[model samples]
Target: MKNIILTLALLIPFSGFAQEFPNLKSTRQDEDYSFLKNDTINKNWYKTMKFLPINESKSAYFSFGGDIRFQYFYAKNENWGNGDQDKDGYVLSRYLFHSDLHVGKYFRAFVQLQSSVVGGRIDPSPVDANPLEVHQAFADFNFINEKSKKLILRAGRQELSYGSQRLVALRDGPNNRQSFDGLKLMTGKENMSADFFFTHYVAARDGIFDDKSNQDRQFWGSYFVLNKVPLLKNIDVYYLGYKRAKANFDDATGKEIRHSMGTRIWGKSGNWRYDGEAVYQFGDVAEKNISAWTTSINGGYRFNSIKFHPEIGFKTELIRGDKTKDDSKLQTFNPLFPRGAYFGLASVIGPSNLIDIHPSISFEITKNIDWIIDYDMFWRYSGNDGIYAPNTSLIYPGNTTTKKKIGNQLETEIVWEPNPFLYFRLEATWFQAKDYIKASGMGKNIFFTGITTQIRF
Candidate 1:
């Protein structure tokens, strides 16, 4: 499937050129670079930095860009379990290589590769898997007029990032990143823009082999944006719609196949910014009819170098119905839908799949450095509950009659962004849930820390 998709993507650009389509945006003025525009063509700084010819008469034009990254981490109590005899101190390392090639105005290609080391082992076992794989491999065709004015068409595997939090991200390819395999159509002029996309499955990992399921899953979504409203300058209104089919082998067994639909409204107004989202899901899980809903509101205030953002989010199951009578208590709530995938952290920590409220604040110390502190409070209702386990394969024998109803967690992080292409992030989390870990006799308090670096081009 990967080979076939790659072949088709590569062929599309050639077909566009064969049809006599001219290279777009090759001669357009980039107002953002005023220095280059003011200087003489021969003495332009950008012209001196350019290693390739700038003449349109040249047979070929090529642009080169890529990044390499390295990361290391330290953990106080890596194992969030009992103070037992287990290796809890070790140095983790990861490396990433990414590159992009743009040829004239007809073709563009991207490639990403990653490798990792755990506990001094180069190629660790599955339990220590660090996702060493290819993140993206695709070609693009620009089918828009040279003058930036109207409609545009982009096809093949691509990234579609819209709205504030990237909830309906089609191109979130790979397990770690995210990407979509399909087509995207975009059109806009002035301040209004509209986009449409269709994809197959949400690739969660890097390599083609690390895809969630072997069978191709169907997915489609669309987004519309209106920017710079008259009274709401610097503000944008967005709407999104998406539907996906489960790709697991047991999907036929109704093991929580997801049918999700959601929308969001967000933008910035001076020192204050806000975003809100709502979603609904309907499906059958494990022969039981399932329906659920979720909503969230996030707002922030910026003061000098400090920004405080407090968000409240919630999820509920409206149709537990008669299914609860026959199935085990644990089978009531579907594990597929968590609070929200944001900030690269698990939103809530508890069972019942019920409710969560998170509040966070961040401070910037320097131009390229910042810190974030957040807390998440989780509440689970009776019937069924959920918890995070390091290894899902293990089953624990425990009674939930005495389970705690509230789980409190604290998370802090320091982020350093030296440039657009490179970033270093360090994070630590502490949580307490009496019944969080069923196997561990003591689930009172758990702490863990991780550090990572990323480079993109």
Candidate 2:
């Protein structure tokens, strides 16, 4: 009760300030560096702290930004699939400071430092803390500039995201989001763009300056997007490759090398929008052959003119699973570095070896407030394979009582964007355990609630 009042007190003032002070003006002519133009909620804060600018010029300029986020989470029956446990309440906070330097258009540098901490948890995990470390340190150099196209070479650690984030994502939902150490070559025109990279995932350690690239794994991929194609709205075609020295799955442990090829098509017409994606994987884990695939489709319609401006949508996914472990073939689909909140805000399940259907609706309560509700249902793709969590951990092994029903989840989220730099969100989720989870070990349903607030600058 005290936390709720304190949270409200902290958030209420930002709403008044947003109306009193418009966002600061950016010196740059283009919206590329504008603080309020990058994201849907306009939460970028790069230019908001203009009073602290070290130097400003046309050819060379330096700016800084910071973000602070706090979240309170409570979950009933925390680990339902494995066992029954309850975590009443916990608080998580993350702080980030970054510097963006640009020396003309051809050369630039970016560095970000993060400090993440968590407290009051029932069971604390490794993903919680890193006192301080460089989150992103990258140098961008453009080699070719054509009238309608440009080629840029970026080196060092950076962030990589593509498509709808069903597969590759930054994992921002966690206290310590994931980053990578890699080099990338990007080429693009006004309507087309492509990215090629070879990189390694960064491992977050508990202490400061201890984070480093994971030596056990490597990721390489090429992603291309075409926005001006005829009759295609927008198309994304990609090929991703992953290699790990050691991996275990399906009662087998060995070196794993997997490749995925996929395409995503999406667009909007009037009040209707649609997205479809499909991916196929083929590789080898030691001597075992790997064959897996996943598909996703979602569409939505919006009534912009109506009161509250509501939007309704539905989504479905099909991910392959192994039928039996008798053969030298493994069939569990792997979603590499997917978003932390893939299946709604609760994010209890990941898109691996499963089938799911989700329906959602959202509406704007005011110009600065919005609310969303969703109901998601899950099932195992192969009854013989059993259920797995988002991290590919075997929650229930194959033939776990011959139960295929995973569960159903109902979730709601409310977001308040007081201004471009300040935002608040509250989320609640109820997960009803089904045959598989209950049969395994679950004693009670799962109820989760999270309250979050962030100041981007």
Candidate 3:
């Protein structure tokens, strides 16, 4: 079943390609060359000869470009539980490949594949195995004005970035990108722009889960932004609304739904850059009525080859339990919402289940080199009593019983760019927790590291 699904997915893009360039005839010499050479020539020949409009200006016609990346990671103490263990030492953590293809003045496409190994296993789930997965497959369209101003209309699985702090990022599509079947419209002028987007959910893949069950999920959201305000030169403002409905096969048997609204303001003055954001969420999870809020602030300064950024953030929530006694009515708080990576080291220590305060600094070492250092502090505001709680024995704590717990994390990374088309990155981290929150089903005082290389054209 998985093989059949994979075959179908692989053929879908080819089908689209065939429809888009059906009339082109191949002039390659050998049959084998036809297959291999066809892949490269089809795109180039189509763009140059077939797609170009006669009498069109060079800039008005079509253009093509793309990028690719490869990555690997090395880690120590790889035991992520679930009946798995990692010996203390070095290990190949990941192998990743990504590519992007742009078409005409308005269309773009991208795809990513990844594989990894840990604890001597050849294929592990994203949490434990080595596998190959596609990260993106999308297209974009741009609109132009008489004066050559820029406007854009994009659809398919595409990425989005907005807000001063990315608080309501429905797509979470960067570093590890998340895309959706959606549409986006935007317009921009010198140093000013606005954008709007709508998206429907899709499955997430990262070397985990069998392909059979990897069928796409469903979700939808809308985001908007107004940036580059003149009142505060170098400043921007953003607003976003996001909604996500649980997938059909989600683990939670009860209805799982979420809605988020947020706003952000940011700007730069001379060598200083400042930003802040706030968000509110309302929804039902596992049949539990839920409400939540979050906020963050950040500032930075730049000096020639060196740059520094520092940030802080927080989250709060209200939950209502099921009505029936047997259903176990309960309200829980999740601490990791606003800043999952608050402490650089903790992000590496274990899964960011919840509860944290984070701050960090990043620097540009040179034209092609850079570094970032960050720290995280954690505590439980409310939830089940056992591991995530301290100073209280209540089996099921309410919002009132929640208290501050303690944990800290540190992280650092170095990036190297050899040229416009090539680059490398390395990272390391350490974490420490004071109570069961860090040890229960999660790691404690753990360490991790990773590396990646990329090329573009």
Candidate 4:
């Protein structure tokens, strides 16, 4: 009650904001405001903050931008009442500011600072609180910069993402997004590109100035994307490598080394869009041979002739699980650095050792306002393997009971974006516990509601 009203009150007027006009990018580092340089007549009011001439140099300039987000969550029986019950709900606030300095066409530096805090929550997780810290600090050295192609070397702390954010993502759904400490080589053209990097994941500490790269884990990968090719356009292929000193799974916990090779293909035509991805993982864990895989299909169709222009969307995923608990082989597909909200706004479950079917419909209520309704069903891909959390944390181990059905979830959201810089969303979810959840231990259903507002500038 009061939380809902207070959440609505946080939607302040923030016309003075972040992202560039029209093509507002999710990743701030990718924003390009060079077109503002020619607007001598001050066509856009944001030019004062986005385009600043450095010592009157043609190639040297500085751009400043920031964004603040407020999120409130009201959940009953969180995680099926498994852990951390807070009937009073919780609120989260995140502030991110960044500066981009370009010395010339060949060199530049980007730095971003982040502060995230929580209120009215009992025993917050490490990801929930970060008083203040550096989120991204990197330098780009462009070896070849042209209108059609680019070759650059980037170093330092940064964010990495790939097609659809199924595997590698920025993890912006949570208060504290993910970052990496590494060096990357980027080369690409207008229609295609490739990224290669070797780095370590940053461990988020609760306090300020204490976050650092994890010493026990190492990540390396190569991702390539091709678009506008003949017959087979819009394709992504990648090979990812991971190593951790200690990895936890239902079967065992030990040092793990895994490698994943995958590809994705997607396109749209005549109000219809589709995407499909497949992955194969092979590695060794605790001297046991590892084999795992996951595949997904997503498609949507829009009714262009309808009054509301509604779109019907569907997604299905099949992630493999451990075959047997007593085998010398381990098979648990890992969702490496996936998006925080992999399946809509209610992200309680992750994409590991699970089978899911999701269907959704979204329609525009009015100008800049939209509404969405979705439902999802889940079951254990392998009854021998238990379910997992969004961060790949084991929730339950395999039990003697053969019930594999986890539950069903229904969710809805209303999104209102009156302007380019300010946005608001209200969402609710109902998760009904099933026999499998009851067989494990608890069978309490879960109810979750959230309100979110963002001011980007």
RMSD of 1: 10.1
Ranking by lDDT: 4, 2, 1, 3
Q: TM-score of model 4 relative to the true fold?
A: 0.95
Model 2 residue 198 distance off true place after TM-score fit, in angstroms: 0.3
Total backbone collisions for each predicted model:
14, 0, 15, 3
Model 3, 318-421: lDDT tens digits are: 22112222233323222212222323322332111245556666666665677877766655433332222111112222233233353566778888864444
Whole-structure CA lDDT of model 3: 0.43
Report the Cα lDDT for candidate 4: 0.86
User: 1-457 in candidate 4: lDDT tens per residue?
Assistant: 3543553455443344433366456689998877776778745546767878786654788888888888989999887888768988889898899999888789989999999889998887766788898999999999997889999999999999988888889888888888999999999989999999999999999878888999888999999999997776689999999998898888868998999999999999789999999999999889677899999999999998898999999999999999899788889988988988886556777899889999999998897899999999999999999888777788777774688998999999999987777788999999998878888767799899998988777
TM-score of each: 0.66, 0.89, 0.61, 0.95
Clashes of 4: 3
Error of 2 at 261 (Å): 0.1
Q: List the residue pairs that clash in candidate 4.
A: 17-457, 18-456, 18-457
- Tell me the tens digit of each residue's lDDT in model 2 across 1-457: 4554564565554554455346422111111343322234533342344322234534566666667788888887776635435446878888877777766668877788888887777556556677788888899897875658989888998877788888888667888777789899999989999999999989888788888999787999999999967877999999999988887665456888999999999999899999999999999888889999999999999999999999999999999998777688889888988877777656677787788999999999999999999999988898778566566666667666677888899999999986866778999999998887777775358889998887754
In candidate 1 the C-alpha lDDT for residue 375 amounts to: 73
- Top lDDT: which candidate number? 4
Over the full model, what C-alpha lDDT does candidate 1 score relative to the true structure?
0.45
Off by over 4 Å in 2: 1-31, 34-57, 81-87, 145-147
* Weakest lDDT window of 10 consecutive positions for candidate 1: 23-32
* Residue-wise C-alpha lDDT for candidate 1, range 1-457, written one tens digit per residue: 2432443344343332222212212111111121232335455322333223345543233333233333343333333444543344444444445444445565555554544445543333332334565544556565653444445455554444555443443212111334456676767767767777666544444343464421334555566666666654433333333332331211123233455565656676767777766655565545554455555667777774334323222222221111133353223333231223232332223222335567777777676788888777654443233333211112222234435344567888899866444456788777666443533445445565666554433
Best by TM-score: 4
In candidate 1, which residue ranges exceed 4 Å CA deviation?
A: 1-60, 74-99, 103-107, 114-132, 145-153, 164-175, 202-213, 229-257, 305-354, 381-383, 387-399, 402-406, 418-422, 435-444, 454-457
